[model samples]
Target: MNIKRIEDTLNEFNKIGYSRHGMNRLAFTKEEEKVKRVLIELCEKEGMEARIDHCGNVIMIKEGKNPNLAPVIIGSHLDTVYNGGQYDGSVGVGVGVEIICSINDRNIQPERRVELICFVGEEASRFGMGTIGSSAMAGKFDQEVMSRLTDQEGVSFPKAVENVELDFETIRLASREGERIHAFFEVHIEQGPVLENHQKKIGVVTAIAAPTRLKVTIVGKASHSGTTPMNYRKDALLGASEIALTVEEAAKLEAVNGTVATVGQCSVFPGAMNVVPGRAEMKIDIRGTNVESKQVVVLKLLECFKDLKNRRHLDIQYEYLVDKAPVKLDTKMINSLSTTCEELGVPHLQMVSGAGHDAMNMASICPTGLLFIPCKEGLSHHKNEFASIEDIAIGAQVLEHEILKSM
Candidate 1:
């Protein structure tokens, strides 16, 4: 590994964004555009052809001895959550470029072309659409959904991109044409304490969990708090409260296959100290390593609601906001990553990712593997999230080695 090159490469983009607290390069914003231009400049400086697609994803290609073969693609997103850490997505983009530069410096002719991609809209901060770039590349993005989405400022997805001077129709068309990625590789922080807790240096991801986000509403009659009798009144807040507890109980069941359910948001209509709430809403999030297990938990929650609606005489309704499914990465890619870690004397652990990533969408188009390097204290999506240069350097070597083996 060329330590000087890697450090200089990361430094080029590390200072791209700044905030009162820390970094804030949310997708489609002006700050992120600056980062994209820097990416193009660095990639072109290394003799790689850089192109930005309709979805605003930056793809840089280094021609191989056989330029026609399906390229081995290594990438991560450039966008970040509001006030996010620098290393979350930026590390992979920087290290990926370093890998190509290192190969070029060594005068090694790779068997296939290699692409370093910087996906946009990976964070839910802007549009709540994770993997916007990769999903478009995989031809799985839903225009209807995008049309209906709005940001916190009430900006629609199409409007958000338009504000950034991007054409929505072009982005939709770009997504329809999925790229031919022979294999996809992404290096990201573990965002968990597993690696550091076990004293491991690397993590070969086994699977990435997908979350189902839903909004549940309960309706009942609002009545005078002091005059309403407990048995005579149908309390919406009470029903919602009971359902929330039931959601927890359902996920805790042993038969549910380790599914985790959370009702993290709740609201009561007529939110007052003396008012008996007439309506209540709760946001539900359920996730598991497999889609079936997640569906099972959802079914269980609905059943519990059915019994409550029947017995408590309340109206229950719920709508699915997101239903992303868990994905199993390519076994061959996982093995290749593990084998390389061992060959290079890098300490690694095999684990499941509890968060969503662009790699999850790439799996729809080709075999994809996510490499995890420990973040200090397992923190991510914040200013304090960090990965040591030493761990990152090891991950880059493992990535380059794995790419070579596949070629």
Candidate 2:
């Protein structure tokens, strides 16, 4: 494989959403379209046929010797979170392109078709909906679900599709026949410290954590901070703080089980410093591979909410935004990837993914596997997030081997 070509592909994509903060290529934006054009152009130069599905997934196909066989699908999302790192999604897509380029260089023909897909709207940063394209293709989504997804600007998800010239009404057509897909594979950064701290080069993902997201709202009376005595105040911010700590404590209790919880977003009402906050809103994310453990944490949080409502005399209500079950990938696919690593003399660890990805949804339709390469300090979703080109090249080589084996 050509390492320079892979580096060039990633660098070209990195330039599309370049900002002082980092990459800002949110779903359905012009930056996404620009990157799609670049990918299509690159694939076309290598004699691959490319097209955009009704759901806006960019698909490029390299026909093999036997066109009748099911196609092996590879690639990842092109969109990034707001100010996210450059390597999160783009690296996988770049690897897909490089794999085909390597095959072309060797003048070899495979036994089955290979496809690269850059799924659109895989990040929840914009429409609060992640894996949109993949879910639609997996038959896991419908119009009702799409209609409920909206961005911070109050733009409906369907409207965003229309803005991008995609046919939202015909989205159901995007669903692929299960028999047509031989397998699905994705390459991503570990987005955590495990592989790096363990001195491993790759991670063979065992399972993906299921996320339960909740939006909590707390209401309290706004009052003067000074005039109101300590006992007489109804402080919403204080209530929010307590809830945050409660979440932490609950997750800590289940740490051994790998259950984790985070209160990622908090908003307080009232502009003045003197006024007791009238309301506070929080977005909580809880995830784990064990359903019982994650449910225990959720129950603990609910109990905390009830106690806080009574003792603090605050009105607290919570709504579930997402409640999904954990996904275990295909064991055959997992073993294949691990064997590939061993054959290539690569050090790898079998691990679980705490972060969600398009592979989770793709697994519903066909056999799927996820590979992880370590990032610096396991940092991701930030401007400083860095993954060495050498590591990426190693990952690409492993992925290339697996693709050929499957074909």
Candidate 3:
């Protein structure tokens, strides 16, 4: 395996989204398209057939000996969040390409074809609707879903498609069905410090939990900051703060399913130094591997909101942006990953994912597995995010060997 060559290709891919500070390949943009073209060029050099679907997903397939068998899919996104790292999604796509090329280099004919995909709009940085390519491919997309999505700049989904010079009507047709899919695999950076801290090279993900997002609004009457007594005044920002603490307490003490919660965004209305806050909006994100535990957290949160509204004489409202159940990956793939890592002398561990990935959506259509390599200090979605090429090569070798074994 030419680890250096693969790493070099990753570096070149990084330049496609090069920014002064970090990477900037937001989904469905021209920059992302260039990344697709670069991958297509790599596919052409390897004599693989490359195709792009309506949803702007790139798929390259290396035909195998038996034309009758289902293809095994291996892929990851190519788009990065704003000023993000290179290996976040490109690592998996690059490794898949390398595996297919390696097979062709050795002239080994396999029973099933190998496919590498670069899913478009996998990052929420573009439209806040991520996994568009994979969700469309898995037949999980609809007109209502697409119509409801809009970017921060007020660009709608269809409009963004036009901006990117892609066909939106064709996107409606980007669903896969009736085709045999052996399995789907994704190799990614751990995006966490667990692997690095544990001195493990590979992570065999057992499950990926779905997160529930809520946009909460707390309203109260504005009052004079210094004149109003604390006992008489209802501070909206203070109410939001109480809700945030309640959210954390519920997740930490009330949940038994490894639940976690975060208050990522908070904003106050009528910002002023002397004015008491009248309205506040906050974004809460909750995730867990166990379904019941997720429910418990939400229930407790709602109860607290009701109590706060009545006691503090305030108005509290929340809307869910994302709500879904946890997904358990393919048991066979998990076991196979373990065996492969051991056989290859790569240290590995079984764990569950706290973050979301395209693999979760892919699992809805086909058996899927996620393999993770360690990143530096578990930092991702940031400028300093990094992963060692050697670590990735190790994880990729195990992934490649496992895929070959299944064939």
TM-score of each: 0.93, 0.94, 0.96
* Candidate that scores best on TM-score: 3
Q: Would you list the C-alpha lDDT of every candidate in the order shown?
A: 0.86, 0.91, 0.87
lDDT digits (tens) for residues 65-110 of candidate 3: 8998889999899999989888899999989877877787788877
Residue range 1-407, candidate 2, lDDT tens digits: 78799899999898899999999899998899999999999999999999888789999999989989999999798899999998999989999999999999999888988999999989989987788889878877679877888898999888888888887889878888565689999999999999999999999999999999999999988998788888987788889999999999999999998999999999999948888898999999999998999999989988988888889989999999889999999999999999999999999999999989999999988999999999999899899999988999889999999989998
Model 1 misses residue 138 by how many Å? Answer: 1.2
How much does candidate 3 score in TM-score?
0.96
Q: By the TM-score metric, which is better: model 1 or model 3?
A: 3
lDDT of 1 by residue, 1-407 (tens): 77777777766776777775768888888888889988999889889998878888888988888877888999898888888887888888877988988888898889898889999889888877788888888787788888898988888899888887778877766662455668999999899899999999999998998889899999987888999888878889999989888888878882346578899999998888788898999999998887777887888888988988888889999999888778888898888899899999998998889898889888878889999999899999888888888888888999988898889
RMSD of each: 2.1, 1.9, 1.4
Task: List the candidates ranked by TM-score, beginning with the highest.
Answer: 3, 2, 1
Q: lDDT, candidate 3, residue 174?
A: 78
Error of 1 at 201 (Å): 1.8
Task: Provide backbone clash counts, one per model.
Answer: 0, 0, 2
* lDDT comparison, 1 vs 3, better candidate: 3
Q: Which regions of candidate 2 fall more than 4 Å away from where they truly are?
A: none
Give the winner by TM-score: 1 or 2. 2
